[model samples]
Target: MAAATPGLIGAARAQSARKTFVFVSGAFCGGWIWRPVSDRLEQGGHKVYAPSLTGLADRSHLLTKDINLDTHIADVVNLIKWESLENVCLVAWSYAGFVGSGALESVGDRVSSVVWLDAFVPTDGQRVADLAFEGFRKAIQMAADKGEAGVHGLAKIPPIVVAERDRAFAESKVTPHPVGTYLQPIKVSGALQKVAKKTYIRLPEFPQPHFDKALADCKGDKSWTTFELPDIGHMAMLDAPDRVSELILQAA
Candidate 1:
């Protein structure tokens, strides 16, 4: 089926009942990346929580080779548990799809739905690095082998991947993601699949290493609602907040 247009998405969203949301950022980024979309969602009377993972964003001071996928999963899982959040819409972008899926094993019953936004959906025991192309996987592994990859083992966001206006800002904010997070095998209990609803949003305008396979999986699955945002990059929450919010609301 074709994706709903922004206008149609808006119409559907307007009638949606407010719900709680938790957004996990992609590699090398913090929860701050979801501010644009979260703000819009909140304005529509929803509760939103965008938590930074353990070793990235404002939490970079805790970076270590020991910060594996489980650590990242704990970060979000703990948030929901601590806040007593329920009936949630969990949104994971990029690598966090792996992290987020693992986290759901513990709290899937609390979640109302799951959304993979240009993210990789790993099967049980699959790692983010495993889902990626060999070359990209090698690049991340090489960085981890060196103690801290990229900038002190931080993978810098390529300037060209973003639009000209936001390139400078994105460059300043992106940090190196932990190599351990990528290398560690993501474990799932199949709990995420049991959520009442699930959606996958694809940003084909700007490609990523592992998302195409994920997109294909979501498209073929009769259980998932899939949408395509043409000409929007993987960071659609930043580049296309209004549209992203509507799609999310549509799914919610």
Candidate 2:
């Protein structure tokens, strides 16, 4: 039998050192959005958890007027605690940033790193509506007036950015996001800042004021390692999974 190669041994050692990752998806989306990136990390022998929030995507059936930011936060915290995961790299995208911030309050000690992917970083008592644009807040109000528990009709990503073949399926999977999640204020105890390693990946192609502010703030902060992917769209994981995976791994 041939002896094991040095390259193979080194690869094994690197894989063993990889940390677990918990990916929180953005609004109107779910765990499915992280598939492109998660698949790559899993292939590299890393544990990755990307659960759909309470009232989005596959879990849309659970939608209710009462599902708020706290509900989504519990979904993430319970997953980490129940699984007994440690050295986790908590990754949040877009609207899920609020969820990640709240979850960190309970499970911050278990997380070794955090990555905010074009996501809002809200301070204490800040709600998504506060950070969101006036247009978005109006949309949420309209959704409520229409007797809907969730909000829809927002697509920040241009059709051209997604692969032509995957466009239809991708559109079908985006369900109405719980309206309460946007309206409810998130209670943050600065747990997100306490993570040993923090990163922020900004996609400049899809411009939004909140995201612009987030990028600027992270760039100014000494603790955060920031990266700007000017070519990628809002959905970096799907638009450029390889690049997103590389960034996530670097954070870990």
Most accurate candidate by lDDT = 2
| C-alpha lDDT of all candidate models, in order | 0.81, 0.88
Give the per-residue lDDT of model 2 (tens digit) for 1-252. 999999999988997787799999998889999999999999988899999999888899999998989999999999999999999999999888899999999999999999999999999999898887788789998887887798885454364345545566678789988998888888887999889899998888777788888889988999999999886767778878999999999998
Name the lDDT of candidate 1: 0.81
Worst 10 residues of 1 by lDDT: 151-160
Lowest-sum lDDT 10-residue window in model 2:
156-165
lDDT of 1 by residue, 1-252 (tens): 998799988877865677899999988889888888988988988899998898788998888778888888999989999999999999998888887788889998899988898888888788777776667778887787777633232244443255556666777888877888877777777887788899998888766646777778777988888988887766778777889998888887
